[model samples]
Target: MSTATAIDADAAPWSPAQPVLEVRGLNVDYGAGRDAVRAVNEVTFTLRRGEVLGLAGESGSGKSTLAYAITRLLRAPGVITGGEVVFHQPSASGGPARTVDLLAADARELAGIRWVDLSMVFQSAMHALNPVARIEGQLTDVLKRHRPDMAPAERRARAIELLGMVGITPDRLSSYPHELSGGMRQRVMIAMALALEPSLVIMDEPTTALDVVTQREILDELMRLRERLGFAVIFITHDLSLLLELADTIAIMYAGQLVESAAAADLLAAPRHPYSLGLLNSFPALHGERVKMTGIPGSPPSLRAMPTGCKFHPRCPHAFERCSAEQPALLTPAGSRGKRTVACWLQTGDRVPPEPLGRPEGDRSQDLAVGGH
Candidate 1:
């Protein structure tokens, strides 16, 4: 796997014009009534045009559910209880941009928007790809449906171009999914996602099973493609370290709710949430003085019988009286230096905050993530 020249996502100059997608108070439930468990609870975020927003958290954090809900891929048992998902798109008249509430779009409306304006790359490429169909067939199937007027020769050419963009050779287009390696399959998934030239791409841990070197190479290629295509991304994964390098901004999810959202640099330098700090500490640093690796204490709270007050109160090292008494709402406090939105009582600043033990405020998150790969 060969890596491409990469642009520093944080160092890039980005002018955020209008959000391409705005998800407001979106809630998803597994069942109905009392038995219902909220998989995504009032999750809110905005993805600026051509920006990469990373959603990071542990397993069962509802990142995948949020992706499915946004794409309207959630099945019957998974019902969206409330909130709005607005997608900003160019209008037919090419005047002011058009806005469509994805949550409210009917089946026909959604079908038209799905592959045309937005696309998703699922986690398991092996499972998502058709074992019977060759790569060329799968790639051209998208074009044939979306571009009915396209000639066969044109479709074949387009498929070849898509494969080349993802670092795959045109000759491999005839090979079946099983014939390709895991990394190659993942790249094919990415190519398929981009087949329709969607303005936004949602990827759900597409490189989780690949080796670190392969992961870096794939990410480099993906970033290279994004720069060329100018597509916004909503990348979902548990690796905050990867997001710190690849994403412009990151949002941390805990127990189906957003605990913190900030610019990647800001979050890495000064994380306000304890869970965020814990997650950063879980991964080992590739450079700098390496201490013993520490794991996050305990497990995520069970959604069925959610912990009262703060969901992470049970295992929070800095938990106090208020943590178990009242749930904290995501808020930006006075005198905050970063674009930090934290849901911890320690961050509210109204009350005297807990001291970070012996660690300096600026060094805490760094201690966890300094020189992290």
Candidate 2:
């Protein structure tokens, strides 16, 4: 949370191309000093206003850690060793924008910013909600806390409006979390997150446990809300195909580091990194002749025993002598057109990739992996 005012949906128009959140050289560790194990390594990315930036990777790729670190929600043994999370918030009353470093914000400052300027929807709806409290209380409690200037009747009306926006009727307000279906509960969580009209919403696998149909419905709702509210979203999930459709840009992480980042359409058409190609091939194509699902050869390296050079070199099919001996930095490819960047020797080094960086779109027969796993 930063000392930034909330953007008024009606008054202050959103600048979609402007940078809303910037994370630079962010590093997160699990413990202190000698016992520390790095979980998020020098991660850097910029999220533009009113954009959907999807973060995709394997289970242990530090996606969640990076999100928590960015929001200053890392707890206990988890520690942020370095970096800056700068938030650029527009003024509500036609004033100059306010900038603040979220990592340096005190508890009071954070309290003022959370739910007002920034909010989050966690992985599980059931786990995020209060089991004992009614939905009405849960929704209104946020307004009560953050908008102390508002009267009780106003909070109740806002709560009803929030639930309605998420497709929940006011009659269900008296029901407890357990009384609602899984989708309804998830909608409630989303409603609560949107109650204060936050500028950015971090959704960490919000639909993980639901059925595919429910997931689609929730995603559609999210897109509709994003359109209406003009809020940026950092959607963290492992489903590459889903990200292909839902995200404007996608960032792929591996072993606590970003291996590749590009526009969603570009990344889907051509992933530069070997690891990214492996992940894309692992999923069955949405519309094409059926192809066998192939997984990456090995599991992710443990945080404490990470391999030298590129962290993915051990499991990467394109790994070569240079990959094992020297680490690669994230950089634009020689003849690239846009902001696409990758951390792989094949793209960054003098040597070129084995084939054209990508296959023809919708053609799944030509996979990046040379051998079967």
Candidate 3:
């Protein structure tokens, strides 16, 4: 992995209101040369200040890989072959922003910026926490490293405050990881991520293992904290329904590339891509009239032997001749009132646009269509 130190970061100016994170032409390879298997292919996106951007896709769609790549947490063999990840953070004294390419940041720079500027809440709470350590020990570790000036008593107070923020009692600070419930453990993970009060937090399926009710509770609590603290979030999950409820914007990934991105309401109401529509149809309506769950027909393509052109064409019901012959670039459509971008030929008028599947039963006035959009 490489960070863009060659760009002379100090010489270039940065916008005061620039996006928190910007990724351009990002590519990830599992191996080198002829044996390389491209996991993420030229994926690009941006995260604005204090906004929630939800990422959704089937397994192997590169959602988690993209997150790991952005945070410089990707392991060996998962090489970042190309791309620029720019992080814009406010100056130490709240002056103008400092822009740095995460890919080019050296170990020293990365260590300085990680918890203070950006943090990650991994997928598995049980695995993320150390079984042997007490909650106070775990939380205080970050304080000791990043805030060395903090006194021991002050650090203990801060740890208790963090626990209270996540709805855990201060008394639990003495308890070990195994003593907490699954939901509590996940909340602890969120607390740890927030201890430094970073500008952006990337949560990779943080509530995947919890029960539905517990998951919803954790998400609601997270939203409350976000509103209170004003931190941007990149919430990665395969659950579209959860995103529709919480995210400000949503992006759908298919076979390593973004297929559609729009405001949460717009994408739910009128998903432009066939894959997005199929995914919407796969989930049952929680409140509306019950409908048959219709999953996408085929499985995701393998990285080693990916299909030519649009990787999703083979599974897309609306795909045409051009889809298999040539790939489509993501671009904004003509009638989109907002910043809605999609990678479908039909939307770009390369083919006659088919009528979108009608709204799902029992919720005609709602923003999404589960029957098929």
Candidate 4:
């Protein structure tokens, strides 16, 4: 997987000005009627072409649910109740781009769009991979299904190339899922996801199971491939610190709703929402003084018995009267530096954000430890 011999066929020229995916007022629920518990609530965000949008939050924060909803991969009991997901497919010859309503797309239409236009790298490699099948079969299987035009030999060659792109030796293509290391299995999943060079890749905790060193290597390889292939990514993770490094734009989710979204640097320098601040302070800074880690107080609210007003207000230390009385909309802060938005009353008007909301001015580059799920 040297960059010099990389394949460029999947690198479709795209206009960065146009968004690749737009999720508007999306909602997902489990079961039906009153028994239906909301899993994703009015979540909205835009992912630009070739950009990395990171979705960070605590475990059971609807991160994976949101991903499944967007990709229409939700299973029984899970249903998309409302909202629209629009996918923009760029013109191959630089003409007007075509837009597809993902929510309205039938099975036939989705079959045409998936793999070629959009793909996903699921969270767990061991569970996602087929234990009985060989690595070569699994990798080539994707190509065989989607790229039917390719000959048998071509598919095999592509499978080998895909494995190599992620730093796996071609000789190991014959190995089964159980035969490979965790990192190797993860890399195989990545290769399978990229077999067709999708325009957008939804990675739901892609590196959760790997060691730190292997995680770095795989992430580096992924970034390199994204650069060469020109694809966008929705990176879902619990590690806010990791998103600070990988994502261009970061959206923080809490209790099934988006509490804040901003450029990665802006969030790092000055987190506007108390939940975001709590998340940052919860980790130990890699370079700062020995400060005590103050994790957020109380567990997340149960979907069946959610709190009134803001879902995070109970856990937010800076919660005020207004926070408990009215739900704060996700709106831009007054005099915000970038395209940052937070759902907190403190940042609504002239009121100053809490002192703890921001890192010290002297150490804005406070690298925090990556928390687990």
Candidate 5:
């Protein structure tokens, strides 16, 4: 699908003053024949400076696809059909800002901006790190590539300082990835991503593999570093409870499309979309008594053969005949906080009564309790 034709009818207009990273009408397709799949469909969101935007959804909900598309890191089978990722650069003096369209940038342009201006921390830190390389070598590699004029001694000193910044000892720099624990390796990845002090950092389930205590520690450290560095963060994960503690805003995605976007507190307090409410209810709260958590009834639809009209109609609790025949657009709801938007027929003035959207079979309460929903 072309980016121009994939946009939602009610998508908000783009403005450079408010957003540091803006994605407009993004579409990603895999394969070339008639069996091609559209992994991401007209997804749009803005990340402001010094803010954390949480992109939450299930495993195949296209959250990671959007992240990779922003960085131009999609593989051969996957191609960004259209859309623009505009990154605003502060102008020298007091002049107007400069915007770079990441999708249209050539390799040389990408080289000048990547890592130096944008960085990423993948989900599996162990797989990302080179097995044969020392921690110090991996850390210094970034500096050596971006800031080649620096002396070797200075680079080593910077690497040690970065390790300390992430709460790891400088001595650990000599160790290999296998020597450190899972949490430690994750910290090293964070340190490497932050070494150049980029304006934006995209993290894909950075703490998913760690234990609860370690996850909490890493998130706390990340918030502290964000405050110190003043960079925007795009945090992608399936855990909503953890995002409540770290994200300033939240965007919920379903069936490869963003169903809702709102301020974190507003979304937790009152979600406009039924899907968002179901996701919130699936979690076990720390303060509330143990209750049977409700998981959303159906699984995500296959991207290659999505349902007609609204892709979510088949699973939406508030869906009606109109929902099945006509797709709902992302529109601002009344009493919404800030720039809150929801893509659902109920939010678009539908009068249908709420009904059961089918619940997942089996008791998943234990799973919810342990997984933090």
Candidate 6:
């Protein structure tokens, strides 16, 4: 893991010149009429060039829904009701300025942009790949789809090169999806995603199926590739520990909303939202000694009947009387230097201070040093 600190507010890493993708007030609804459920509720985030943003949450937190919505891959019963996914494409003049508004783009416009501008590596890499097709054909198919100008021979050469780029040998190109190991298949999916040199890539639970060692290796490889290619990435996962190691920034989702977002270091050091703090405490450290993990109790609320006020209040240990009546708006820290944002009544100064919750078994005073109470 890189010891490099996140870019400070003064650095402004997400400059207009380098903005690759921006999603604003994005909302996605599933089902219809009385059965409708709002999967994503006004979620907003941006992916800057060469940055990795980890979207972390438990199951049913709408992290996957946000990813599907951003890629325009949502299926029937799932509709993007509101918000805009803006994709910036570099202009011919070579200036940093680019075009925007991807959601409004027509099929022809999307055809020219998809894969070539934005690509995705979904969670189930094995299922995503064609079982009957050889690796070479699968990769070549992507190139042929977007770059039809390339001949068969040229496409084959490109496929070999891509396989090598992903740490697979050229000989493996003839192997079918069933022939490759899980990790290798995941890498192959990554290679296919990058085949068109898309400016942004969305990876949903990319390392979930792999073992610890393989997960570490694949994630390391991904970081190396990002350093080399300079494309933005949105990595969605439930593992906060992995996110701490791999992501530049971390976004915490609860219910159907983004509860908190901050630099990975800052978020780990001093989480603002109660849910984010609980999540951080839930994960056992990778490098540190193993401790008894106190997983967050209670399942996530159903999207159809989300709790009023703070959706997390139902399970939050710190929930007070006001928590059930008024929703908290997302707000920045009063004196924070960067883009640290959290949606919580505590941060909004709505109620009187409550007594501190008792610490967990492995709690160390120093562990809370970063994100002060």
Tell me each candidate's TM-score: 0.91, 0.92, 0.93, 0.92, 0.88, 0.88
Candidate 3 lDDT over residue span 284-370, tens digit each: 765666667778998999998889878899998877788898898999864667788988887875455664532322233655544
* Best candidate (score: lDDT): 3
Cα lDDT tens digits for candidate 2, 305-368: 9899999899987788988888899898666787888988888548757764643334455533
Q: In candidate 3, residue 360 scores what lDDT?
A: 26
Question: What digit string (tens of lDDT, one per residue) describes model 4 on residues 114-211?
Answer: 87789998988999999999998898888888878999899999998998899999999899999999999889988988988888999999999689
C-alpha positional error of residue 307 in candidate 4 after TM-score superposition, expressed in Å: 0.5
In the predicted model 6, the residue pairs found to clash are 269-370, 269-371, 270-371
lDDT of 1 at 336: 74
- Report the candidate with higher lDDT, 3 versus 6: 3
lDDT of 3 at 275: 90
Q: Which residue runs does candidate 2 get wrong by more than 4 Å?
A: 1-14, 356-373
How much is the lDDT of residue 86 in candidate 2?
82
Query: Once model 1 is optimally superposed onto the true structure by TM-score, how far is the C-alpha of residue 8 displaced, in angstroms?
Result: 35
Candidate 3 vs candidate 4, lDDT winner: 3
lDDT of 1 by residue, 13-46 (tens): 3234777888999999999988999999999888
The RMSD (Cα, Å) of candidate 6 is 7.0
TM match of model 5 to true structure = 0.88
lDDT computed for candidate 2: 0.84
lDDT of 6: 0.80
Best by TM-score: 3
- Candidate 3 wrong stretches, greater than 4 Å: 1-17, 357-366, 369-373
* CA-only RMSD, every prediction: 7.1, 4.2, 3.3, 6.1, 6.6, 7.0
